[model samples]
Target: MKVVETIKAVRNEVIAAKQTGFSIGFVPTMGYLHEGHVSLIEAARKDHDFVVLSIFVNPLQFGPNEDLDRYPRDFQRDEKIAQKAGVDVIFYPSVHEMYPTNMPMSIHVTSGVDVLCGSSRPGHFDGVATVVMKLLQIVQPNEAYFGQKDAQQLAIIMNMVEAFNVPVNIHGCPTVREEDGLAKSSRNVYLTNEDRAEAPFLYEALKEGANLILSGETRRSVILAELENRLGTGSGRIDYVDVLRYPSLEQSEQLSGKVILAVAYFYKNARLIDNYIVDIQEGEK
Candidate 1:
């Protein structure tokens, strides 16, 4: 597990790997490694000859009032976990290395950024697309791995790859969750003991939404109502509950094909999100 912090070093090593005909897999992350992150690493290790995990907490993705300053970090602990997950190289670059100067041009995100998380957080996906493009350019891997936990982000990245003709194959792995069904996140640590106890309801609500959709419910408003009702059992503040087409993330009146039941809620100071996707055939219940 070699760790390199400079842009030149990462690019040089990746170029060397390409010259040697080794297939590279990349996993880009904001630090505070958790089981969810490890799942992506493990997937990359399984499919590529070498796996590169970059743990740079991107400043661009964060809004002014967001948790950028307090966003968690423990590089020492993350290094151990990455090595254990069979990561070949850890690209731990500094902010200066990633952004030595202000970005000269903004990566305008046309699609997959006007809804869901993107709707509330303006310029968020632009930041995500820009940083992801930079990292993808630096690594120039044959394949890259991302978790389905950030479904919208995954969709945006996929869109960016297709639109820009980036050569890397993008893979969206399943969302890793706790035994009780809460989706694993680095921010899960912010939950109070009471908040943690109520947090699993986020997943439970999404599951119920999936079940309802699977049982032949097609109305969008009904499903949203049911999901909100299910999540309301907890003492948490509801952020948003939405259902949209998978990958495309467009809104639809009828639920069919692959659809995402996504929800975000605030429990104390912690904001938690969870979702369940259900694919319904043309005529099947």
Candidate 2:
């Protein structure tokens, strides 16, 4: 795979590909390649004529005291992984190359910006939307792939694209998990052995929430209480446990339509998040 660090270099190649009538598929990521990331690249490879994967640990998306500096980086390893995953080009740009000046304008959505991770980490989604907007503009891909693991972030980006009328199509892929049911994350490496053992409960709790919803329990508060009971095993301090309407991130009484059961917890100095999305049956009212 061709790896270029400059935006101009990447843009020239993308323009060339477009001129040749090739549809571009883009997967934007913060480097620390895992099987979850590879899964997205594989999906893009299957669908698009040309696939571009970007590895930029966007500083704008990180909070002031967050793990921006200590967040992992291994470009050599990531390069090998991307090439093996069939990426046609890797946009490995430095932070300065991508952000030459201070971010004058930021992207924010009023509705979904105050819950889940947004509650704790304020301005997180704003950074996410801004960088994603910049990347979409730079890559100019026909389709972009994002994992559903960050269900809220995915929803916010979808809303941003729709609100701004960006031309690129966004595809949300399924969450990839480990054999033990822990949703795969680059931050999983920070887990201690004990913390790792207790981590799968996040997924388990989400599954239990789904089961409760399926078994005719329609009240969101009831399911949320049960979810908190399951996650409050003292394994890690609970950050938030929410069941919001999917994509919109709004609260609802009836459980019909797309709904997401989500949890975020702090375990062993690493913050972990997991969620399960369920499409509730319509005639349950």
Candidate 3:
């Protein structure tokens, strides 16, 4: 329940925790606390002696035309939620604290940033990797938690960890969804009443595509066509629907081992993304 806004203060506390032999678990978020975000904090709390949650709305991850200024934030409310989730420290830093004037350097991961969300939003992953690397350096946690709702982002972070040899364990948790199946997102607040009702179809369509693959369909074209058909019924503008390998995220023609069905669409002024992972059993034919 302790809230620290300065990076030096948070870093000092983390250093003290390490000296005391306490393991730290970190959850980095662009603040608009939801069940999905709280779920990440709770998971971190379970495995580590101390849990730190960062609530800075990263400007780097947002494009110039994107909703960075209007992105939802309520730190007072977020603090309460974090405390309830057993969070030990809430690292709420200002933009200047995270990125000083003339911050020239940035981190980039080349493996999974060329397609899907990355393809649509140029320079998005660079911002993500940069901020994440900075946060990891500041907190120096033993582990970090991210939701599978952002499958590609998770993959990119994991790739960065491996390639850079950062000594932190990156854990991808399951996507938390509403009862009707819409993947919970902070931007869900931007949807209209009608848009909210129709939004769940994104997840439904992904589930259907996964089921089709499980039912012995291997043709990527046919599966993607079916997914598009289902998502087309929703009110949002469909961005993309793709099926690819698990961590590699390359397009796949056959359902062999681990496959992911991912989609992104725009509802109202908000763009949302979701994905599902399925294990394709061998010898099903």
Candidate 4:
């Protein structure tokens, strides 16, 4: 219920909770709160004694032509949603609060920036990894929650934790969707009525592609082609349709084990993404 914009204030609350032997859960997000964001908060609250939700719209994670200036913000709405979801603290920091200095070293993402969303948006994941690291350090939570809708970003963060030996645990919660199958996102507001009607096909395409994988179709190129074909039936522009190993995110001609069938599509005004994660056994697929 408490909202604090200063680092000192947030640390004071978290430190006090730590001293009390209460486990901390942190959900870092930009301001707009949807069912997907609520799912992350609920997951954090389910197992942790205290939950801290940070709503800082990070500048580093945005591209020069991206919707940084126009990205949605509704503090009162977000506050109500977080509070209702059992959030204990809302770290509402400003850009200056998070980045006071002029310039400094950033965590340049070397490995996982070559594909998916990262492929088109250069330096995007670097910003994501940096801000996530910053938030993790600031909150010092026992566990942090993120949505699997951003499958590549989630994978990068999970890898960042292991590679850097960060103390906090990164949990990838399921992607919440609408009744019609569109993934929940802040940018969903940008869709026109026509685009909105056509949007659910992206998820359908991903689901169909996942079915191919589950039904003993192991060829990565075949799955990718089928996904693209399915998405091609829609009116939206196809950004990327790929199938890569989960967490590792490496491509394979013959996929084995857990892999994500993901797609990104551009509506007239909005870019939407959805994915299906499936595990393949050695002989089964």
Measured against the true structure, the TM-scores of the candidates, in listed sequence, are: 0.97, 0.97, 0.96, 0.98
Compose the digit string of candidate 4's lDDT tens values, residues 155-263: 9999899999999999999999999999999999999999999899898888888888888999999999998888888988998889998778898999989988888
What is candidate 1's lDDT per residue for 1-285, written digit by digit as tens?
A: 899999889888888887888899999999789999999999999998889999998999999988899999999999999999999899999999999999999789988778888987899999999999999999999999998889898989999999999999999988999999889999999999989987888888888888888888988889999987887788988777899988789899987788898888888777887777778774211
Instruction: Between candidates 1 and 4, name the one with more favorable lDDT.
Output: 4
Give the best candidate by lDDT: 4
Candidate 3 local accuracy as lDDT?
A: 0.89
Which of candidates 3 and 4 reaches a greater TM-score? 4
Prediction 4 global C-alpha lDDT: 0.91
Badly placed stretches (over 4 Å) of model 1 are 282-285
Per model, how many backbone clashes are there?
0, 0, 0, 0
Best by TM-score: 4
Error of 4 at 54 (Å): 0.3
- Candidate 2 lDDT, tens digit per residue, 47-97? 899999999998877889999999999999999999999999999998889
Off by over 4 Å in 4: 282-285
Which segments of candidate 2 are over 4 A away from where they belong? 282-285
Candidate 3 residue 22 Cα shift, in angstroms, is 1.0
The true-structure Cα RMSD of candidate 2 reads: 1.9
- Clashing pairs in model 3, backbone N/Cα/C closer than 3 A: none
